[model samples]
Structure formats: C-alpha cells, structure tokens
Target: VRLSVPTGFGHMVMSGWLIEFKRQYPDIALDLLFDNRVDDLLRDEVDVAVRVMSEPPQQMVATELAQVRYVTCASESYSREHPM
Candidate 1:
C-alpha cells in the first residue's frame, strides 16, 4: 500500500521514524509526498495519507491518532522583550 506523508516541520523533526516503519513493513510499497496541499487519492498519487489539522472529507476514512497540545515556544530573551 502506498502511503503519503506530509513533510511539514513536525514530520521533518521525526523523519527517522520512517526507517523503523520500513524495516517492519518491507513488503508494503510507499510513496512520500512532502507538501502542504492534499493530493487526490483517486488519481492514484497516494493511497494512505497522514493529515494533521485537517477536516476529513466525506469519501475518506479518518482515524484518530493521538492528541497533542500545541505550545508556542520562544527564546527567553525574545519573550522577555515582547511581553504580552
């Protein structure tokens, strides 16, 4: 099965995870597309898509993965200078 993964900031940070997945599922084929836009699955560009912060369409099946808290982190000096 082909899987399409978005190569956003978070994905880039955890790029090494793919290596582990590949080792476990060596038989399955995968095609990775790194972009902010979603591709048409019917066109065969990708089979499974990993989407974050996106509402699911009617034709697609969505599975809830994990919940994460969004935190905006900045340097101490920067925050101190630009206090709210």
Candidate 2:
C-alpha cells in the first residue's frame, strides 16, 4: 500500500502504530510518502492519504481518525519581548 502522510507530527503518530502493523502483517509492504501537500491519489499512485484539516470536502469518503491538540510556547525572554 502506498500511504501519503504529512511530514512531522503525522509521521510521528503513524510510526507509533505502524511498527505493530508491520510486525503483525509482515507479508504486506507499505510505501510511506511524507509531505505536507495533499496529493492526487490516482495520479500520485497513492492508495491512502492522511491529512489534518478543520473541514474536509463533503463529497470525499472520510472518517474521523483522531483529534490532536497542539501547544505553542516560547522562551520567557522571547515571550516578554513579543506578545500576541
């Protein structure tokens, strides 16, 4: 299977479980593409694609995979110098 996934966070998340998947399904092979852009599935020869979006197109076959919480922080000095 050719799987398309985002570079950083998503790659980390997928690696967590894919280790077990490989152990269980040793006969199958997975090709993972780590990129931030959404690929044309058919054109890119990708069987599956994972992405993070607040909203997805209504026409697509989609499922709620997981919800991730993100945190933003800066050093005390940087935070003092720049305020949101």
Candidate 3:
C-alpha cells in the first residue's frame, strides 16, 4: 500500500515509529512519499495521507489514528530579545 506523509512529521517524531512498522510489515511494500502540500487522493497519487491537521476530503474516509497535545514554547534568548 502507498502512503503519503508530510515531510516535517516523518522527519520528526514519526520516522522512528515508521521504522518499527517497516520491520514488522516486511512482507508488504510501503512507498513513503513526503510533501509539504496536501495531496489529492482522488488522483490516485496517494492512497493515504497523514498530516497534523484534519483535512480529509468529503468523499474520502478518515479515521482518527491518534490525538496529539500542543505546546507553545520559545527560547530564552528570543524571549529576552522580544520582551513580550
């Protein structure tokens, strides 16, 4: 099965998990396509797309695989420089 994922997420927290997935599902071929923009599923370019935001098309099916908590942070130098 083909899988399309954002380059950002794959490189961050997701890459390690995907490596485990690859080891488990060695029999199945996984095509990892990374892009910044959302892909058109109808075009058959991507069978599945994983993104941080929920943007599934109306005609397509989407399942909430996981929920992520958000955090807002800034560096000490940046904070001192900005002085907010």
lDDT of 3 by residue, 21-79 (tens): 98998998888888756646657578777877756667667787777688778999999
Question: What is the clash count for each candidate, in the order shown?
Answer: 0, 0, 0
Top-lDDT structure, candidate number = 2
Q: Write the per-residue lDDT of candidate 2 for residues 4-82, one digit (tens) a residue.
A: 8888855678887878889999999999888777546678888877888877666557777999788898999998899
Report how far off residue 34 is in candidate 2 (Å).
0.7
Clashing pairs in 2: none
Model 1, span 1-84: residue lDDT tens: 666665673376436777787898898766766655565776856766777765777778999665546788889999999995
Give the candidate order by descending TM-score.
2, 3, 1
Predicted model with the maximum TM-score: 2
Cα distance off (Å), candidate 1, residue 9 = 6.1
RMSD of 3: 2.1
Q: How displaced is residue 30 in candidate 3, in Å?
A: 0.9
TM-score of each: 0.71, 0.86, 0.75
Candidate number that wins on TM-score, 2 or 3: 2
User: Of 1 and 2, which scores higher on TM-score?
Assistant: 2
The lDDT of each candidate is 0.68, 0.80, 0.77
Give model 2's TM-score versus the native structure. 0.86
